[model samples]
Target: MQTVASESGSTLRNYASILLLLGGICLGSLVGFIFGNKVEGVKFIGDIFLNLLFTAIIPLVFFTIASSIANLQKTERLGKLFGIVAGVFLLTVLISAAVMAGVMLLFPIDQGNTLRTIAAQALIDNPASAHQALTPSAGASLTQVLTVNDFFELMARKNMLALILISLLVGFATLRAGEKGKAFAQFLDSANEVMKQLLAMIMKIAPLGLGAYFAYQVGVFGPQLLGVYVHPLALYYATCAAYFVIFFSLYAYFAAGRLGLSIFWKNNLTPALTAIGTCSSIATIPANLLAAEKMQIPDYVRNIVIPLGAPIHKDGSSMSSIIKLALLFAMFGKDFSAPEMLLAIMGITVIVSVVEGGIPNGGYIGEVFAITAFGFPMEQALPVAMVIGTLVDPIATLLNANGDLVSAMMVTRIVEGKDWLSSRLNK
Candidate 1:
């Protein structure tokens, strides 16, 4: 009975911690909104937190990945693992793009009018600059606009696809190499272990981080920010919901009817709330772990897939990205042919999702990438992404939190002698 009581107490504490953090954010945002620039002080603290998160991300990726790949066996299982990951990844991207395409059909951003409105505005308060170069040479033919060169250049700049390619190649090569490679891999393993511990230490600072982040956001934009981006944000959020409902609904229905839905909801609700409130997966991991335990999922599944999936299989991010690129095309009066959209979808799915891990989850990485790639004013994209992405965060958390379960279920079924793919598909 003490064991049961202890478990209950721990669960309560976990849930309470999440609530406390969220309450702090809301109160801070309210205070900042009312006071405006007065909260600039808090924003300064948030800036430091952002720097710390960004600092941790790059090393975390290189070390963890190097260590993971280094330990891969010479067995054929490595090939199978990559194949499955690649297949699922492509499927996730396709699903998200399809959802976005449908959303576009329903609520197409009127490009000409949006551009006209932007042009008429007295201020280009935060115009992106790199997109300026990519803007089709004023009347460049569709053929040129959708050229192999532009796509290739985008990749060369580590624009999403390029980074994924680099990371995958490096990881796989390290795995396939002999003794020296294994030695390097071991170094990376120790590095990843150290980073995780460092992250735990970092969490001690999160109350201040959350306070500062919200203060800056509220101070700079106030409530008007939400109103300004409401429409696009709404569309983004809806697409995210569509993906969650379509994909997970089917998975649950096929998995165990009401029981499956209950299972997913029970484990997912808190994480989903944290994702919505915090708007950062990195900030929500502790809650996700708490929710996972209640589901009684195997430790192997949680240990492997949760940490990995938080950064990978980011269907929500993919959808927002496609929309962001489409919006950028609109912002600059550039056109998007079918091929460009398709390429953008594929590139974001396969490349952006992978490298996005190394980029700070809620930091300036997206803005930096945009500034570097599109030569756009760095101010706009990250803020824009965050604004647009708010629509998707809750659903993204749902997808992400449950993607771990999906990986677990699929793997468990595979080991249990069931044909996971065929069986689930038929159901």
Candidate 2:
């Protein structure tokens, strides 16, 4: 009974902390909106918070990936693990795009004329910039990603995939190194622990950091930001909420029926809320890790899947891409009924979703894909699309972060059998 009471109290505290952070976001946004430019000085707090998060990213990725890979190698299910993760990831992306497309059709953004006028004025004001933005540059990003010409460049946040590849290679090598493999794995595990501790220390300041950032965003963008794009923004948020509830519930059911559904909601609530506050899936890693620990997921599965899923399992971002493209089509007066256009929209959205984690303001960068692939007039269409991304990023991130944890749960069930959760509870 004492143990039960203690567990309840801890759970309550965790839930409270998440709510408090959310409250901070509301309060900060309100204050910033009210004060606007007058709150410029307060922007530093948000900047510092973001900087701290960025600072932690590399160490977190390296240690977590290396340690996870090493542990999984010992299990010899590494190949099967990757195959399952990839299959689930692809299925989610397709589902996200399909759901988003259907929702947009139902609650379509009907502000086409207003959006067109706004873009026309932007084009008139900055024709040169618009021209440059509109030019096709399809292979530039891919080339840069593949070149690896500069070693120092590979370590940047945007090059996390590169780091991950390197880490996997090193991890596998370490695994094959015999007794030395054990010591190396232990070292990496210790590093992961150190990084986790560091992240916890950083997260102690999350509410303030997240609040400051939201305030700064509101101040910069102004109180009327959401009002200006209310139609699309509201629709996007609503659709994402539906996606989270409907799709994730279905996923939970498929993964473990009633018990999985129960565990999914219970484990994901705090991390989902945290992701909403931070608007960065990477920022929610520590919280997700904590949730996985509480859920009794084995460390190897948790570390391998959650970190990799952060980048690859981007169902929410994929949905956002479709939403953005739909809005752009409406804005530009394009006929969406064309089969080719629909295929282009879905294809580019999936591609953008694949690298969403690497791009800064991924929601915004996804607009670039619109410009290049879907033939949106860059100057006029990009700004409107950016507004949508900014407005919808938090909810999208919440879904993405929650999806990562659920993927962990699903993967654990696959690897450990359907009774995984029940067995953990019994133990």
Candidate 3:
């Protein structure tokens, strides 16, 4: 009875905390809607919060990943963990692409003349600037994307993929080192704990920080949501929300039955809000980690999966890539439903979700690839696609970031067995 009462009290407090965070965001959104651009004043506060999270994430990712890997009882477990992670990522991306493609078939996203007019007007206004902006670079070499010439470059958040790779290598090296590496392994664990504490301290202000950020987001970009991009945005946003509610719940239940579903929804709101509010998967890592911990995911699974998933396992981007391609096909009068085109779009979605996802403005490469592949004029179609990417980014990030948590749960289920959640709860 005492335990039940304590559990009830804890659940209530958790809900209350979630309400406070939601209240802050709601209030900020209200301020933005009320004040419009005047809400810019508070953006600096949000920036400060973001800066602190960004600052801590580099070391946080490094230490947590390295520690998780180095401390694994068996090297075979590491390989198995990654194998399962890769499988889950691929399966989810395929599902996302297929779902979005089906939606496009049912209700085609036709920007009609509106997007073309907007693109042409922009080009006319500044032909040189528009061309320069829309033109894709040769695209970064795989070498450049995966590694840095200088070690210090890995410290930047943009190079998170590189950091994760290096962390894995270091962990493997430490694991191979055996007893000689014990001290360093201990150091990594200690540092990881410290970084977790630092992240907690930073997140204590998330309500304020996220509130201000959302204010700027709504105040500045809210108006833009209604223009030429409205139809596609509406479709994309609705699809993402539906995917989040239905598919993610299904994933949670698959991971561990009814208890898993309940725990996931209860713990997911804060991370979901963080993802939408911050609009960066990397930025939401800390919050996702916290939520995963609450879900009682093993440290090794959550730590490795969350950080690694930030770069590669993007279900949201998979959906967005398909939407962008469909939008372009609609604008250009291409038959989007052609068998070859759908197959090609699914292939590209996988590439965009995995390859371009980590690189800065990497979506440009995917968009340019889609445009060139489909024979659309880059100057016109690229601008329209870019606008769609920007508008859907927040919600996309919501799916991208939160998807990692559920993936982690699923990974835990596979690695630790279907009884994993039950065992944790029993403990």
Candidate 4:
């Protein structure tokens, strides 16, 4: 009885922060519904919070990735970790794409007249948006995406993929430096710790920051959630929720039976909330890192996987890609069921999921790629895809951010064995 009481108290303590965040977000949402655009004033508070996270992200990612690799006892471990991470990322993305595609088949997303209305309104709001060309050439070149000509360009968040590549190279260099690199590796570790502390400090205001952000989102975009978008958005939100509950549970169980599932769901709330509130996988990295730590995921795995996943691994985007394709096909009166079309959709989904978050304006680039690939007129189709993308951004980000944590768990299990969680807890 005493142990039960103690455990209950501990559980309450563990959930206290989540409760506060939830309450703040709910209250802010209420205010938004009441005051509408008047709540835009509060968005600046959220921006300040987001900016702090953004400012810290490049350095944080560099330190975490570099330190994790630099301290690896064997270079072979790096290879194994990378291989597992890539495999898991690809598998999960394919699963999500298939899931969304299946959902679309069961209940096709037809925009009907709503497409024209929404498109017209979008064009009215931004007269130049329809004229804007998001051609493949507009996207970062392969060389530009992976390697910045000026080292200073790597410091920008828009060049995150380049930043990650540079970090890997630096880590490999440090590892190869042997005894001479010990001090530098220690410095990387120390810097990583400092970044973690900075993130924690920024998160202290998350309730307020996230609340304000939610208010802004609801106030500005709440009305747009109606009409033609209602069906597709409903499908997306419901699908994401199902995927979050169902597939993530299966993943956790796969990682370590019931224990993994319990731990993952228990620690997932904060990251989920942060992701939804910020609508950014990059911004939610700090919360995901904290959750990973609480789940007892190995430091090296979480450190490397979560940061890398932010830029590249996007189950949410993969799912969204299929839905976007379905919606576009519906609008253009194309047969989405053709085998060649399905294959192209799947391939594009993988590319968009892998590439979207890594480059500047990548989401738009992916949408444009889909539009042009399907032979849709860019002027008409681009606006529709962008609208859908914006409406689903919050839930999509929730999946993308939290997916990284679970991916870390799976990576740990494969690298550290089936008993990884139990062994860590026992220690």
Whole-model Cα lDDT per candidate? Answer: 0.55, 0.70, 0.75, 0.75
Model 4, 1-427: lDDT tens per residue? Answer: 9998985676566445556666766677778888998998898887786567556656766786788779766436678778899899999999999999889889996656655454454456446544432222234356865688898898765566677678888998999999999999999989978876776676567668767766875686664434555777889989999999999999999998899999999999999987876667887899999999999998999998999899789999988888888876775556677776777688778866764564433465467556644545544565456556756776888889989999999999999999999988999
State the displacement of the C-alpha of residue 294, model 1, in Å, after optimal TM-score superposition.
16
Write the residue-wise lDDT of candidate 3 on 79-182 in tens digits. Answer: 87788998998999899889989988998866556545544544564465454334332334558646898999988544555776898899888899999999
Candidate 2: lDDT of 112? 49
Count of residue pairs whose backbone atoms collide, per candidate: 8, 0, 0, 0
Single out the weakest 10-residue window by summed lDDT for candidate 4: 131-140
Tell me the TM-score of model 4: 0.59
* lDDT of the structure predicted as candidate 4: 0.75
> lDDT tens digits, residues 246-322, model 1?
77666554445555566666567777766655545665677766765565544655565556566666666666666
The clash tally of candidate 2 reads 0
lDDT of 2 by residue, 1-427 (tens): 9998986676466456456656766788898988887877886786676567567756766776677668765446678887887777777888888888877777776654455565565466556656543433332365553346787875565455466567777788888886878998999999978876776677667668767766765686666544646666677788888889988898887777788788778878789877866667787889999998987788988887788778657888888888777776765556554676677667767767764453334444345545545445553465456445655766788878888887887888788888888777887
How many clashes would you count in candidate 4?
A: 0
Deviation (Å) of 256 in candidate 3: 0.4
Q: What is the TM-score of each candidate against the true structure?
A: 0.60, 0.60, 0.58, 0.59
For candidate 1, the 10 contiguous residues with the lowest summed lDDT are: 114-123
